[model samples]
Target: MRASDRAYATLLDEIQSGSLPPGAVLAEVEQASRLGVSRTPLREALGRLGADGLVVQQSPRVTVVADIDAGDIRELFELRRALEETAARLAAVRGDAAAFADLAGEFAAVTLGDADGLDTYYALIARFDAALDAAVANDYLIAALRTVRTHLVRVRRLARDNPQRLAASVAEHRLIASAIGARDADLAAHATHVHLHNALESVLASLGGGTTTGGAITTQGAA
Candidate 1:
């Protein structure tokens, strides 16, 4: 990565890892010093972050990171579920053979209980999602899914705490990949909904009654 890109990636990593947090005001000088980069490159980094919806820009001030709330997380997940269900259905019908091949490999890696495969699993998920999104071929659905992904990233960290849930998620990913490979739109949509529903349950369980920001957690197996 270029110097500016490196700095930008570093900041984004910190943000996603919960080190910077939502609503935290970051001083450019401190960030530049911390990242061992010049202020100019740091500024460039922040600009890109802003564009990615990871940061917010305002008049007469440096950009600020967006604040996350339970409502925001909940709504984002809801949108993701809706959009992805549609995308999976379309991808199944369209039969993008190359993308399906890639997704199959990712699904295999995710099903394996190896430590190093986790990152690869997530990367495969991103690629799978992008491919599905492309197959959907609706600009509005594509745009909405992008917004939902930004906030859903926050809750994703919580998902790591539950091994069983993660394994289940991988299984669900495999189902969608396989179903899409078979050109089964109905099955793809159903599998996508089922997986996302379980994920929502897991996330809600993790945040249950912790704070007002995490929202409602069902003790009665709501899923």
Candidate 2:
């Protein structure tokens, strides 16, 4: 990989993992030296991160990780609901039913009793996402979903300690996958909506009620 790509990947991982938390200063000279890269490539990486909304230039020379709060999380979920619900509907019409059936089965079997199991469950989710993208076969939609998922990784880390939420998520995903497998586009979309609703609630609760805005969609029987 190029130096800039390497730097971006490292910094992105650190930021998402909270190793470099919000508001952490990223001095170009210091960062260049730490990553064994020159200022030019580091700047390029920072520019890409800025485009991704992960970093912000405080002045002409100083940069820092962007802050994420309740508002940002709420706005993110709003977009997530739109994109994922649409994706589920499209996948139900265009995707391979057998594949989604297998995924549903996998989701049913998922166990999160330990760290390894959690990792496995997330990996399975990744596979499901890949399948959705392939089934939808829409470049523009997939691109948007990718952007939502970028920030979603960080948001997910916030709710990692909630075992009940994770278990609920597994069942929710199974319903969605099963609906898609059955070629029930309406049900798939509805399931996606319900899952996102519950997910947003769980995440906001994990934030200790930090996102108190009523902008989130109100749903009945979440989870």
Backbone N/Cα/C clashes per model: 0, 0
- TM-scores of the candidates in the order shown: 0.73, 0.93
Best by lDDT: 2
lDDT of 2 by residue, 41-119 (tens): 9999999999999999888878999988767887898899899999999999999999999999999999899659989
| CA RMSD of all predictions | 4.9, 3.6
Look at candidate 1 and tell me the lDDT of residue 149: 77
Worst 10 residues of 2 by lDDT: 214-223
Give candidate 2's error at residue 2 in angstroms.
Answer: 0.6
TM-score of 2: 0.93
* Residues forming the 10-long window of minimal summed lDDT in candidate 1: 209-218
Give residue 96's lDDT in candidate 2 (0 to 100): 100
**Stretches of candidate 1 above 4 Å error?**
1-6, 36-44, 47-53, 56-64, 97-112, 137-144, 209-223
Taking the tens digit of each residue's C-alpha lDDT, what string does model 1 give over 1-223?
Answer: 7889999888888888888877777688888898899999998999888877778865546667777555555666667877888888878887686678668767866644676767777887888778877787888888888767766776686334677877888888888888888888898899998887777767766765322223343343322
